[model samples]
Target: MSIARPDLPRRLAAEALGTAVLVATVVGSGIMADRLTEDVALALLGNTIPTGAILVVLIMVLGPISGAHFNPAVTAVFVARRELAAADGLAYAAAQVLGGLAGTLVAHLMFEHAPFALSPTVRTGAAQWLAEAVATFTLVAVILGGLRFRPEAVPMLVGLTITAAYWFTASTSFANPAVAIARSVTDTFSGIRPVDLPGFIVAELVGAFLALGLMGWLLAPRKPTTVPVATPAE
Candidate 1:
């Protein structure tokens, strides 16, 4: 028996709820890590693992419903590929942003912090911008490549990519616009200053576009070579 596909509303809900949970995990873990450790490396390690783990869980659970595009950059790429309509992409992005903000609020409430506060953390400069771009490029590349080569492994690939990116990239790979925006509201270990949002967002978009272009060509199917059949001499 064939299963019925999810409707648009269900898809939107999945996108929103998935993004909310993802952001909540990111912010909550960061807060917990910050409070538990004075050592920056330890705090970062604590923050990184949960974020990666949650991505795997969220993607596996919500992927069928909405493609699990918790990131606007990913949504944009889908739109560009004509896999998703522009209007639907806009709606998805709105839901994602709203849900992400709600997640930040939820995290803060659980931690007894203010409902909303602008981050004081200063993340800026050319190196940081370059890092954000590189981080997002690698993230989108991994996603596209994984989907092409091993669709079943995408969730784990994404999770592992982010986990490694957190340690290697200077910006800690806030490669998602929704997550970046949500994170700007909390002055915690994962927060980025509001002023820095523009740069990071721009860099992320640039990176995503680059990945789409490169991966589109790389993953494209090539025309099979035609061979002339030789007739046997009778």
Candidate 2:
């Protein structure tokens, strides 16, 4: 069977655009929640539920074009697993970052803030970094685990895992590096500080790499048998 070589540029653009919408919806909901709710839990529920649905829906819409990797960590794992070519990963990551930046700016406008959220001096401390690593690890594991050969369900499962991570994990689960950066631009509930970005990114990358190693061990091809039975004389 012949499959057309995926247009890397088109896929990357799809990633960028999908990620932008994800960030926009997530952050915008946060900003609105901060205004309406006094309890942090309630505020977070408002942010995560819609984001989860959006992820599932958008991936179904865009997965055919982009493979729907909105996170650098996800793309990195794809490369390590030989699922995504290296050059393709690079372009997708670049596009995702750019889309995040644009989404943040637009979110700021919507929230009636210039900087949106912006990171603070103590923004995202050690606890947050640890949280990010764990969160990203869980997300990648679910993604890799749920759909080893079944590409059709990747989007929904990925989104469900993320929503569950947000519900259970600390730091409200920043499983996505690109989304983390976008959150920094908004001063709203979804925002993190710029100072915190690098640490989060590093942690996410590490977790993703760990998942990839596990995947390699579990999914490696078995060695072929050398011995064969002799054929009966005809």
Q: Which candidate's TM-score is highest?
A: 1
lDDT of 2 by residue, 87-106 (tens): 88888888998888877887
* Cα-based TM-score, every candidate: 0.96, 0.88
Give candidate 1 regions above 4 Å deviation: 232-234
RMSD of each: 1.2, 3.1
Per-residue lDDT of candidate 1, residues 31-96 (tens digit)? 999899899999999999999999999999999989999889999999999999999999999989
Error of 1 at 11 (Å): 1.2
Q: Give the local distance difference test score of model 1.
A: 0.93
Backbone-clash count (model 1): 0
Model 2 scores worst on lDDT over the 10 consecutive residues at 115-124
lDDT of residue 24 for candidate 1: 91
